[model samples]
Target: MRVLVVEDELPLAKLIRQGLIADGLLCDVAIKGEDALWMADATPYDVVCLDVNLPGIDGFETCRRLRASGVATPILMLTARDAVEDRISGLDTGADDYLVKPFDFGELLARLRALTRRPAAAGGTEIVVGDLVLDPVTHRVTRGGTAIELSVKEVQILEVFMRRRGEVLSRLQILEGAWDNGYENRSNVVDVYIRLLREKIDRPFGVTTLKTVRGAGYRLDEA
Candidate 1:
């Protein structure tokens, strides 16, 4: 998933970005609240990680503005203060979840996943398309009772397709869903990864679930 991280602490911001990237998430970092507002307005992000102690317009104000502008993206506030008043203020200002400082990365990831699934509560934690089953929480995939090992990026791309199964997704759409703005628009990386994904998920089972639409894009459906 794509995420926007707003943290004034340069080192912490870079560290969060790196961790998110390693976990197969596309992440953009903004050191200032104003910059974050601009970036969030321009890009579609699955979630926002806003630090409470920002230079100007702090996390609470940033979140309030985001909601005021009708940006429905989930916001997870990060704070060093664990005070009840601080937590209540954050929630009152439109934050979806809260995390204290020096938190476990695993817990942070879990919370992000939970927030993203809020809108699609009907889908639950696991996704199943035909014989293929994916546990987003566990990062596990299996088809027809056989386990499948996939790279982090591959799994992320697959999740996008699974979430919107039967819909045609252009290269740009896939890139936006699976990659950050850092990727070149003209790059053929999507095609390369799609090919690799097919080798693992389709070819082994003799199924053509992921179809290429000439002059359009790609679609994923039941095999």
Candidate 2:
């Protein structure tokens, strides 16, 4: 997914961005709190990897402002401050999750998945629309009783559509949710992937669930 990394340390920020990119996420870096606030306001990000100890405003204030500004995107605080008070402060300042420094990348990824995962419409892990079912945790999709194998990005994009259901999600929104911060692709990658997804998920069935919104974006309908 697309993420914004807010850290004062240039090396750390670069490292995090590169790592996230390797994981199929688009990432943007912000070395200052003001820039973080502005970037967050201008762009839609699925998650923001924030560091607590920063110059000027600090991560806490930036997070607090983001929440105050009604940016509901998930925030994961990564910092060197591992004390009880530090974590409490981070949570209190509007971080959805917190991770201390010297953490496993695997754990961080797991946490990020938890943040992006959408709850079932009926309120569970298994999201169902008609005979189709998707398990966010397992990244599995099934139709009736037959399993459909999908690539990682395909699953992620499908999850975004399934989560919103009837709403028309623009290309920009889809890109933000399915990529990382500084995604600079000017190609029709979204359309290409959507076509690929349609071939795998829609063509086999007589039911038409995915629809383009005519210059707007795409929507998912349960049949």
Candidate 3:
């Protein structure tokens, strides 16, 4: 998943970006609310982490403008203010969830996962392709009723494929889904991961669900 983090505190923004990257999610940082507005308009992010106190336009105004512009990307407002009025204001401005400053990192991740699992449009918590099943909430994957172990990056890549089953995805597309802009990987890095995914999700089961489309990209299909 990709996230846009709008935080003026340079250190805190960097730390948040690092934490999200460590969890295998792509992150882009915008220190100002105006910049965040444009970034949100340009990029298709799964979530936005907006700081309440931003330069020029505060997060509440930003959220209102975002909603006015019909951007439905989930927004998680972060603030140091713990007042009931502040929370109400954030939500009233169209924020989906709110987290106060000095919050637990694990809780933040859980909330982001929840937003992705249960979006505004109706959907289930799990994604299934053929006999392969993946649970976003549990972070678990099983193939033909057998468990499949995957690293954080592997799971992120697999989730991207599972979400777009039967569609071709280029290396750049997969990179955008699995890694942040800060990653400076070689072009062949995606190839390596695709090979690893095949070894775990296909070879052992005598399945060929993942296919290479010769100069196009890769595709995941129902077996």
Candidate 4:
């Protein structure tokens, strides 16, 4: 997924960007709040890693303006401020989640996964269609009483399909939401991965939940 990292500190910003890229995310960096505002307004990012204590407009005002402009992309705020009021202000200004630094890369990755995998705030952690069950936290797949193993990318793609259940997802949408942005490979990778996923998660179990829509995209549904 495409992520915007808004941090003024050069070293820290690079670290966050590198970590996210390794996790298969497309990322952009902004060192100032104004830059953040324009970047956010210009691109359709899935998540924003916003720094709360920015030098210019600050995260609070930046977040407020983004929301005011009707941009609802998820925001994960990074802050050194530990006060309850600070977190409250972040949330009140439209940040979806907050992490207090210095934070673990694993935690940040997990939070990003949580934000983008979701179709809505009220969506459940487990996605089910037919006998297939996927646990987002554990990255485990199960059908009936048996476990199915998938590569991380496979799991991510399947999650997007399972969450929507029956909707056809275009290739570009799958790549945008399930894979890292700015990946250099060029091929029918999505179809290849989906076929591979079905070999493990569907065929062996005598289930066929993931289906391709002729001339359209792919869909996953109990029906």
Q: Which stretches of candidate 3 lie over 4 Å from their true place?
A: 120-123
Alpha carbon lDDT of each predicted model: 0.91, 0.84, 0.91, 0.84
lDDT-wise, the better of 1 and 4 is: 1
Tens-digit per-residue lDDT, 112-152, candidate 2 = 87777642334767878777788866778987768898988
On TM-score, the candidate that comes out on top is 3
RMSD of candidate 2 to the truth, in angstroms, is 3.3
Residue 98, candidate 2: alpha-carbon lDDT: 96
Off by over 4 Å in 4: 1-4, 20-47, 53-56, 70-74, 80-92, 96-101, 104-124
- Ranking the candidates on TM-score from highest down gives 3, 1, 2, 4
**TM-score of every model?**
0.85, 0.77, 0.91, 0.73
